[model samples]
Target chain A: MSVIEIKNLTRDYGGKGVFDLTLSVESGETFGFLGPNGAGKTTAIRHLTGFLKPQKGSCAVNGLDCWAESPKIHGSLGYLPGEIAFFDDMTGLDFLNFIAEYRRVKDKTRMRSLLERFELDARGKIKKMSKGMKQKVGITAAFMHDPAALILDEPTSGLDPLMQSRFIELILEENKRGKTILMSSHMFEEVERTCRRVAIIKNGRLATVDSIDKLKAAQVKKYVITLENEKAALAFAKEFAEEDVSETRVTVSIAGNIRELISQMNKYPVAGISMPGQSLEEIFMQYYGGNKNV
Target chain B: MFNATLFKSGIKGGIKTLALFCAVLTMYYLIIVQMFDPALGKMVQELAAAMPELMAIFGMNLNSATLTGFLASYLYGFIIIMFPMIFSILSVNRLIVRHVDGGSLVFLVAAPIKRRDVAFTQMTVILSGLLALTLYVSVLGIVASEISFPGELETGKFILLNLGALALHMFIAGICFLSACIFNETKYSVGIGAGIPVLGFIIQMLSNSGEKLEGFKYATFFSLFSTDGLIAMRPNAVWGMVALFFCAIALFISAIAVFTKKDLHI
Candidate 1:
């Protein structure tokens, strides 16, 4: 079932080319929202969180309209923004406890466990903690409520490798527990490793939404070869239906059934061959348009 | 549910401002009492007679040119009132801008708390702390008056006058809070909040200069708490007291209304 449904969502801030964005995420699935900076990822998230009312169409979390029932919907969702600012004077423990109290639920044991897992000091003031530690605190606060849906934007931007792995583990556990996650991230490897499906957004519009398998299938694959005999390489190239042929070295584009192409290549006097696997990074780069930062 | 958080934030904000005010007041008192020469008494008396009613807005009275009166003048005029004004400005700025800049306001808005409730809690915190500090100063003033003036000070009348002055400060703080709530931009909010009271202070000065523009008196919250008028202990300051109390209520309600309608920019 779809946990979040955004139908032709449009938001205009009296600015020029922002806000005609549309996307959706299903329940119990890790849906990755991929885009470059200022591509309206945060803007769309803001609309979804009901921070900004949509100028057109509708955004409903679960079945609750974001604008009409924000408070009720907010109670069941955990959101971790791309950048989090904390109360500097508050200790990590105090801040977390305060949020817990505001939510009107007590689960200190889970909070303590999360702190231990993140290797965060509960007693340290937020101002004294490093940026990465502060990000960890944000993550902790988002998950403390144990909401049914999680909207995490750039959730792992500042974490070390070990902590990143732990966060990935935590995300997976939440997903397994049937929480829907809409994560916006630049880290394709992280998305590829965890997200079941991915949505590529370009210039505040939906570019594509496909499963990893489908994306890999639709992607253009490259295979490189070094032939011992130039004549054999030419002969293989003639027999094969691959384009962009060169003398000793050749690169082939394969959409399906690469086994035949590999077999034909084997028939040639090949010294060495390399066929790089299709990565989400390549896919992101292909669709990301002008924002090179992606 | 909201009162607890509101009270906590208010008390914390007030205490910080109170500390700053008390420190300045104590320094001014010590200098006036211990450092001045007795031969300067004649010069002080001459200066006291020339003092305008405008200068009394700062709680300054040259009539009693002694250390205690000097302290009262400073505290009454700008120091005490400035504490609440500065506190309101800073606290409101933190709520509007710092929260937006820090990105924590997003988290707060995304939570179950209503926009109106958030504003209410913040205002409560600010007012509670101001009330506490005002009471503390009143008590401190009673002690200081007893010690500095010996038998000349009437504790009962002095307390009533100070209470009236604190009520006026409360009304000004309410205006600041309402301004902060009405505007999302912190600078604009701070500008109007801080500027309004300073403008009133200037008007009070003009009025003291004896121009017949008593209309300015209606706009100045300080007029309602005029220390000289209250200290006179007349039977007709009831109008001022009623206006002062009503202004506080009206400002607070307006703050809530504006908060409910205004966009949560942060």
Candidate 2:
């Protein structure tokens, strides 16, 4: 059964809110919500979390209607807001304890584990904590309950790369334990790493919803082939359609056609080989019409 | 429906401001209670008769020689009325408007408590704080007066005065709380939250300008309680209290309804 369901949830904020959006996350499946800023990512999550009531349709969590049965569903779900707004005078420890108390968790084992895993000391006043530290506090509060489902809005935002990777590892570990997770993020790499299926929202509309494997399979991989000399590279470039036909370098972009390229490359005197840094942007670009809203 | 945790935090967060206002009121109330003299009251009456406009602005009655009249005109008239209105406005703004604007309310609602519960808890906190402040200051003032000058201060009249002040604050707090629930942005929320009470204070002041505008007192939320009138149990005082009670309940209902259904798209 689906742990989360949003059907035709529309809340018009001057033609900017989510419109006719329909999506669902199966129990134990980590679903990723991908979208640019102001693209209704946070708005949709708010409805699922029951912070915002839908004007048009419905969002449900754990088979309970979101708007009608909000408090009931919140007991089984954990949520992190896009921006952490902590009490001005409280320490991180105080904030975590308050949330734990509210959620009625008896054992502090999970809270302690989350704190240690995130490397958060949680002793200083939140007002004094750095943005990354505050984000760590938010992450800790959201996961400490060990709820059956979690909704995180740009959860990895504001963390350093090391912390971001740790967060991805944590999500993977939690998802392995059969927790239903729905996370919204503009960071494609993090989404690719942790999510099984992803839905892309652009300008308050769903652009695409597909499995990560299929999306990755459909991505264009670029290989920059360097020949022994400019003459060979030029001749090789002529035989094959390429991006940059320089003196000794020819860049090939294709969707999983490395076998065809390998046959064509063998006929030339290959000098060096390299691929530029990889990005999910290459495939996501088509949805945005080359506007790289990243 | 109220969540214990949210209500506790609401009271906890408001204690500092509430205490500060209470301390200031306590010190001033005690000082004046100690300073109360029959001779001073007579002198104040003479001054008020000479400058009726100045006296009316403070809601001063002509009978200033009595202990009840002295406190009513001197304390309850302007400072007492102004302070509680400010406290109510500030408390609601902090407890509701600020949290909503800052997006911290999302965290509270993100808990098992529904949005309605969160709003209810906040309403309870604001109401409780104002009630506590009224009770504490009244008790402290009476205690200080009894210790300093036994049987000199009118206890019955003072209690009546406090009730009137409490009712007025109840109504003012409702307006501020309702304002907090109506708007989402900090600027607009706090603007209305603070604006309404401040406007009432101004109207109350203007109504005291002369007899021609005395009827305008009914237009202000603060008119529910006049310390002098409450002590005397005037006919209008009963109607004022009744009016405030109904308006407060209606505003409270609207506040909860609006907050429960408002779009918190954080």
Candidate 3:
């Protein structure tokens, strides 16, 4: 059984909404939602969380209609918004108690553990807390309930690197306990660590949905090399196909010949050699494009 | 059904504003009732007889000897309506639109409940605050009257007067809450929320000036609670109260319906 399901959900807000997007996460499966900003990741999550009513299709959770039965459907679901805003007047503890009581969860052992694991102090007022601290509070609120299913949008957006890894562990732990989670993020590493199946969306549409192992296997690396002269650049460019070659600089793409490419490039008088992180779009181009070349 | 947790949280959030209104309005109600010495009342009535238009803007009747007319004009006229309207505008807008704009509303509706229930709970909190304000006026009016001038105020007519005022503010609260639900941005919600009441005050003031401006009275929601009917202690203005009740219910229902169907950017 799928814990979260979105089918052809469509809402066109001028130029900023999801269109006919459909996806689902099976029970106990950690599904990674990968997309750039304004790619409708949050919009699709909003639909699953029942914050938005679908325009063309339907969103269901645990076999219940999300729009009409949001109250019942989301009762056992934990939702962490991408941009979190708490009641400014209350302390973090107060907000947590407020949510706990709101959810009617009596036992708070999990809430305390979540707070300790996140290294958060629930004493200070939320308005005075930093953005990162507020995000932690949001995470605590989402995880403390011990929900059956969790829907998180950019869950690690403001956490530090250490905390991000800790969050990945938290998700993995919950996954072991048979909890379903659908997380949206921009970081491939985190998604790679915890999410088994990942979905990529672009321009309000699903670009691709595949397993993490498959995507990582198809990943390509781009290297930029600034040579000593045009002669060296041309010699290096001759070995590799045309990427971008100037008089003294050459950019190259390496798929599976990193060792060979490095050895070949070292023969030249290299001034600067650098590799840039591939964005989601670039990764998609390489992940899908590089396979055809093989 | 209402969410108890949300209802409790809402009341806590609203208590400070509710207390401020109750304190300020209670003091004003006490002072206005205390100032009603017969000699001064005669003097004000005589003075008002000279420039009726000036006193009319404040909604004060010229023929003012009884305590009911005195309290109606001075207490129930201008600042009384203004303060509660301010509370309604701020609180309702804060509860609904600001929650969406600030992104806190995501927590409430995301709970295991219907969107309409969230809307209903917040509306209940707002209406309950408005009810507190009206009830304070009624209870304190009776207690204050006993302390200051016994038998001077007809208790029956006083209750009718307050019921009329409650109906008016309920109607006002509904319109403000509707604005809060319609607009996602706080500024737009507040713009319409505050604008409607201030506009009503202006129109009511103009209408109270004379017959030529009476048409403008109908333009404002305040016209449903006639100052003349309130001062005259006519308990039979059933149509006016009925209109106010229906308008309030209609606007409130529309707000809930819009909220459940509307897409939130959260």
Q: What are the Cα lDDT values of the candidates?
A: 0.71, 0.84, 0.85
Q: Model 3 segments beyond 4 Å from truth?
A: A223-252, A257-275, B210-212, B235-238
What's the distance in Å from true for residue A158, model 3? 1.0
Chain A TM-score of model 3 comes to 0.87
| lDDT string, candidate 1, A91-172, tens digits | 8888888788777657777788888999988789999988899889999999988889989988999999999999999998
List residue ranges in candidate 1 displaced over 4 A.
A15-22, A221-294, B1-17, B26-45, B50-74, B94-97, B206-221, B234-238
DockQ of each: 0.45, 0.62, 0.75
Q: Is candidate 1 or candidate 2 better by DockQ?
A: 2
Candidate 2, position A62, lDDT = 82
DockQ-based ranking, best first?
3, 2, 1
Clashing pairs in 1: B10-B125, B10-B126, B57-B77, B58-B76, B58-B77, B59-B73, B59-B76, B59-B77, B60-B73
Q: Comparing chain B with the reference, what is the TM-score for each candidate?
A: 0.79, 0.93, 0.94
TM-score of 1: 0.80
**Reference-based TM-score, model 2:** 0.90
After TM-score superposition, what is the CA distance of residue A287 in candidate 2 from its true location, in Å? 7.4
Checking candidate 3 for backbone clashes, the offending pairs are A71-B112, A71-B113
Error of 1 at A294 (Å): 27
User: TM-score (chain A) of candidate 2?
Assistant: 0.84
Model 3, range B1-266, lDDT digits (tens) per residue? 68888989999999998998888988898888888887787789777889888898888875457787778788778876888888888788668877888989888888876788899999999999988888988888888988888888878877877888888888899988888888888888888878878887988898888889888877876877875686575664646877898889999999999988887877
